[model samples]
Target chain A: MKAATPTGANIALFLAGLLFGLGLAVSGMINPAKVIGFLDLAGAWDPTLILVMGGGLALTLPAFHFILKRPAPLYGQKFHLPTLTQIDGKLIAGASLFGVGWGIAGFCPGPALAALVTLNSSVLLFVAAMLAGMALHRLLLE
Target chain B: MENFTPITGLIGGLLIGCAAVLTLWASGRIAGISGILSGLLFPHKTDTGWRALFIGGILIGAACFAWFNGGVTIEIQTSPGLTVIAGLLVGFGTRLGSGCTSGHGICGIGRLSRRSFTATATFMFVAIVTVYLTRHVLGGNL
Candidate 1:
């Protein structure tokens, strides 16, 4: 039988996700206009997102090292780290596709999910399409 | 656009980093939104519960932002059709790529993962190019 993940772990994950979404919202990342502004370098460039990305990196840099020093995670059996380290064609193609989408829509998975609270019609359409795409990937690729 | 707020951006990013660290410390999971959301759709026996809750938490957080943060302002300057296309591409690309901005850009780079660095560079480069083509060359308004 497969071991069940503890309920406490789920709760902790929920809380973490909540904080993450809240941070995205509070930082104006939920605004696609802001994202578009940042991408619009030739027009009126808004480099504030660089600061946001930088700030996230600054704190996480130290914290990750500290956490990795531990034997294992507090609640889980092991640190579920990514094993793939190669730079390949899939990575390049996928990144390019994602980048084009992001530039066109000004939303990624996190911010898009956070922006769902506003119930904008375009957001709804986009999310629906996104889910469909995921389903298609599952069907065709996996 | 005059809506850029760097201080809040930095603060929000730090909060996101904290959340990412907390998740890793507590669950040994990288706080990658695409991976988490995909897990829900794909369903792993040991992974389902936490995945559902994390996604739920994100929604709840969005609700809180809607309640206290003067509501989220979702401004998508593109047509519904274009938004849908972007969403589909994002979903497919992220899954194929195995990450996104948060996964590769933030957490992966923080760990000094070379794969993430390459992926990040690829995506950023493509996004910049796409934006330039759309905004400057094509005279498009997305």
Candidate 2:
């Protein structure tokens, strides 16, 4: 399969990022309080997050099924899908840790990055620490 | 719940799904925020350029939405210390886990991958429990 030109691929990547950030902002995911409200199942229990996930899955589920059937993507030479299939301790442990952090702060990586546009001090701090954490993981694990 | 916002959430989620589809089709990449950000931090020769452009697009996209929509609402309830701690956990955990919500939750589940299913279940369960502990048991406003 012939890959698309670099310029075409770069433009698509840029547009994808744009759409992702815009979507996060519009969905109110950028608001930590909204995320906390959804996570607070026993409390007020706002269900907006559920709809968000549902909506995302609605499109992605069918789209992925159809797209992967192709030998290659429209532009890319090959799909870079993950190869691992096992369920192991590392996955569970890491997910658990991430869950704790997400519940505590109501900030995941995507919304956290999108929220940076607001230039909020806490957002800045979290992103910095997040980068440091990534670095630490590489140093300690990889 | 009074805080429920179905329309915006669905629309936003669809946008996110579109972004994921576009990225995969054009560049054969998963639109996983953690992976993208980490790749930028630890740059590779051919990969760095696209990652940078994508992230820059995210920032600009958010800014554009804020500018056009009279500003998006954002509420960060976590204290600075807690935010930092949470950020660290998320960064480290996502890296160790090999994916986050976008990667595993949306894309992985869309592909019907067993590992993604397990990861999503684990994180969702743990996050629910965390909210219970922080909100009910500890009775903290975090």
Candidate 3:
């Protein structure tokens, strides 16, 4: 019930991100080949990624329920939840594009960020290009 | 499908869920990677600090894993040009769609958000078709 200070909140988020990255690495989710393997349903398909998703959901489901039942966060003032409930063109189109890109590169935001620690040129380039894309979207749409 | 480690995947996934839970419980924020990264690009005065910290923690955690757990492997078979293009598309699409796997798949799904469900289904279906077309129809070399 005690609200967190700004610094406390920041630290909490940092720890969360840290653990998330570590989990990504340990689970081999940072590996593009693994993701590709999962997507390769035609030949040598890997079902591990889906299992990972399953596991993540298994734990998140209960925890989220417990947290939401609380009046407020332990460190922050209020829950900043997503408000958009209606489906639309932008959501479908964007997700489709994202899925195609994910299929092509086998990288998403989380795994891509985790891969940055390797300092790989390809990873660096991907991150840079992704940031540019985000900027472009902001320029055109927002 | 060959290198599918269910236990490791589950453990790592649990860790990821724990991180998400902690972020929600402490900061009342959904640990959406694209959202976190996007907020960094389009900075608001109040939003800057935590986003940076969270990203920093991700990098630090990855570094720790690399140091302790041998290394993380990310095999990319696609050409460099294709990689950049994919990254761009991913960035643009995720932003336009408002979330990615972590947001829509994990957090949004956990929240039982109908829009997230639709988005997740769209992306999964498209990704499957894309992989099929690229690997089976297009000879698996892109």
Candidate 4:
């Protein structure tokens, strides 16, 4: 009868981001050229990154199916999966913004944050600005 | 989509996916990056296990990426200032939108949440179009 717990969920999310960043780094998806290549419709279009993502998806589907049916999870009390289903303007806007940022920087948040390990000023600046962005949003209560 | 035998790809995906499922099972919460982040920011909630684990996991995972890849071959092509700014934008978007791609796209869509479907679809579209504009129209001049 306690309130909701998010320990497992948080770890899952962090790991997901970490692994995602790692996949980008290991598979070379973090490389701007590779990402741009994916976006490039007229060029050589190296689809190797796509393969990485596809592989990940393949592995993900089956496991989730089996896991969701269990009565009680290991970390919390109930499943907190969302139930809404529809496409809308919010989706379009957010995706557009995310894409623009990704295309321009060649660094998604997880990767960008991870990329900070390189110790380059540019990376640091980006991380700082990212933090600033978060702060600004928080201040505004958005 | 076929002839893919990279154990790294499958195993990595399975591990991350399993982690997400388990966290959901244990915490009774979706492994949404945005929500976790918001919780950290807003501070009304009491649970913090998942958040700590998630952040820690990201750091460890990033190191693992470098380790597995013999030192993640990273190059900084952009200015740090610009990158930070980009991060801010993403943070802002994440806040305004109420969730990040992980929450909406992965967990939300998986659970068939209408809000998540819309959010995920929107995020994707926004990402795609934004990339197009920034790279194509704006020329990513930043």
Which candidate has the highest DockQ of all? 1
All candidates: TM-score: 0.96, 0.96, 0.96, 0.75
Q: Which stretches of candidate 4 lie above 4 Å from their native place?
A: A1-24, A83-91, B1-15, B42-45, B136-141
Residue B39 displacement (Å), model 2? 0.7
Docking quality of model 2: it rates as medium
Q: What 10-residue stretch in candidate 1 chain A is worst by lDDT?
A: A1-10
How displaced is residue B74 in candidate 3, in Å?
A: 1.6
Number of the top lDDT candidate: 2
Model 4 residue A11 CA deviation in Å: 7.7
Better of 1 and 3 by lDDT: 3
Off by over 4 Å in 3: A1-5
Ranking by DockQ: 1, 2, 3, 4
Q: Model 4: what TM-score?
A: 0.75
State the lDDT of candidate 3 residue by residue for B1-142, as single tens digits. 5778777778778878888888889988999999899989988776788889888888888888898988777787878898899899899999999999998998888878898899889888888888888888998667
Off by over 4 Å in 2: A1-5
> TM-score of candidate 3's chain B against its reference?
0.95
**TM-score of candidate 3's A chain against the true A chain:** 0.94
User: Which lDDT tens digits does candidate 4 get at residues A1-142?
Assistant: 3464544555555666566545545555445555555554444455554455455445445655666788766665666554434555655565556555555566555555556656666767765765666667678764
Q: Kindly indicate the candidate among 2 and 3 with the higher lDDT.
A: 2
For model 2, what is the alpha-carbon lDDT of residue B79?
85
